[model samples]
Structure formats: structure tokens, C-alpha cells
Target: MSKDTIKCKYIFEEDYNPLYVNGAQGGINSLGEIIINFYLERNALPKSQTFSVENGKISKENIDKVEPKDLKNSFVRVFQNGVVMNYQTAKEVHKWLGKHIESLEQIIDEQKDKK
Candidate 1:
């Protein structure tokens, strides 16, 4: 498989909609960049809103605040066969991707040694 053909399941807010996204990996040096960029792009929205007020305006100012971005809900679940992690724990799950890649490499090396 080409490096650019990494397939991953991206879950939107509250697991409402799941989309299959393909990101291009810049070889082994750029293993996790794809998912990291995806997370940033997905969650980098304007969370805070602004309002205007007039002089001594005493109207009902009950502004509704938007909920925080659910990082856990919006994350890449897997990256090809090298990365397999849960999406609930965003940071920890992505962190495990490195270890999983290393483990896969080690297993591949061991298999090659046996042959």
C-alpha cells in the first residue's frame, strides 16, 4: 500500500457521524502527522462568540454558550494496520499509535529473522 492511502475512521461529535478519511503519509517520517493535522483542522473552530452592547442597554442578555469541542468524539480511530487505537481517549489513543507502530515493526523484524 502507498503511504498516501492510509485509511482511518473519523468519528464526529458525540459519535453522531463517522466518516472514512484517507490521508497521505509522507513516508515513515510522517506517520502520525496525518491524524494530528486532521484533529487540528477538525477542532480548530471558533469556540468563543462575541457580542455588541449599546450604552446602558438593559435588555434580557441571556446568551447561550456553545459546548466545548469533544476531542474524544472527533479523532482518528486507526491509521492503516500500523495504528490501532480507541477514539474515546484522544491524547492517550494517539500516543499509543507510536508504541503500536514500534510493536508492529518489531514483530515484522522477528518474523523476518525466523525466515
Candidate 2:
């Protein structure tokens, strides 16, 4: 499939300093299953990862320090019901870093708003 099939969106605001936000939703067709992936990027590279939704909650760790080889291994594990996405290329893996950070920022913002 072409990379163009992936959809991404971003938003930015300027209040004293620039604040940026973005999110993406995509999927890969594998073994008759369409795995839908979600991501958010604020001001940096997006994280390449996926979450397992169970009972309306994410069922995976917010992974960090993931190497390309580790990603490949993870994907293999996931394919066999053992692990998760195996990121092969730097480009593919880097895509998720920003989203992870953005997600964290969003959580912090929500907490602040609640307080």
C-alpha cells in the first residue's frame, strides 16, 4: 500500500509561545485483519506503536527506548500472539515518538485543567 493511504492531521496555536498538536489514524492489512492505529504528535517526532483496547482502556505500556531491532522482534512476537509491532525502518519507528510525547502532554493538560 502507498504511504499516502495514511491520514495525519495537526493543529497549532500561538499564545505567548507556539503550541502544537496533531493526531493520526491509520491501519495495516495483515492476515485478514485490519489493525487500526492512533497517534498524537505535539512538537516532535511521533512514536511508532499501537495500543490494545480492552474494556474501553489501553492495555499496553507506554514504551520508550525502543530500538529498530527490538521493534522487529516485538512485531514477530505480536504476530505469534507474544509481542507487538516490529518496527523495521528508522522512519517507521520515529513516527511514533512524537505521539507518545503528545499523549503525555495531553494527560498533563487534562490533569491541570481538573485541578
Best candidate according to TM-score: 1
lDDT by residue (1-115, candidate 1, tens digit) is: 6576767997667746544545533222333332332211233343554455668664543244433345335544344333332345556765788899999999999999999
TM-score of each: 0.26, 0.23
Worst 10 residues of 2 by lDDT: 75-84
| Alpha carbon lDDT at 34, candidate 1 | 25
- State the lDDT of candidate 2 residue by residue for 1-115, as single tens digits: 6565766786555544532324334444464333434343333333465566899998875455333425533322111111124435434656778788899999999999999
Each prediction's total of clashing residue pairs, residues at least 3 apart in sequence or on different chains, is 0, 16
Tell me the lDDT of model 1 at 20.
Answer: 55
What's the lDDT for residue 42 in model 1? Answer: 37
Please give the CA lDDT of all the candidate structures.
0.50, 0.49
**Model 2 spans > 4 angstroms off:** 1-88
Residue 41 error, candidate 2, Å: 27
Error of 2 at 103 (Å): 1.0
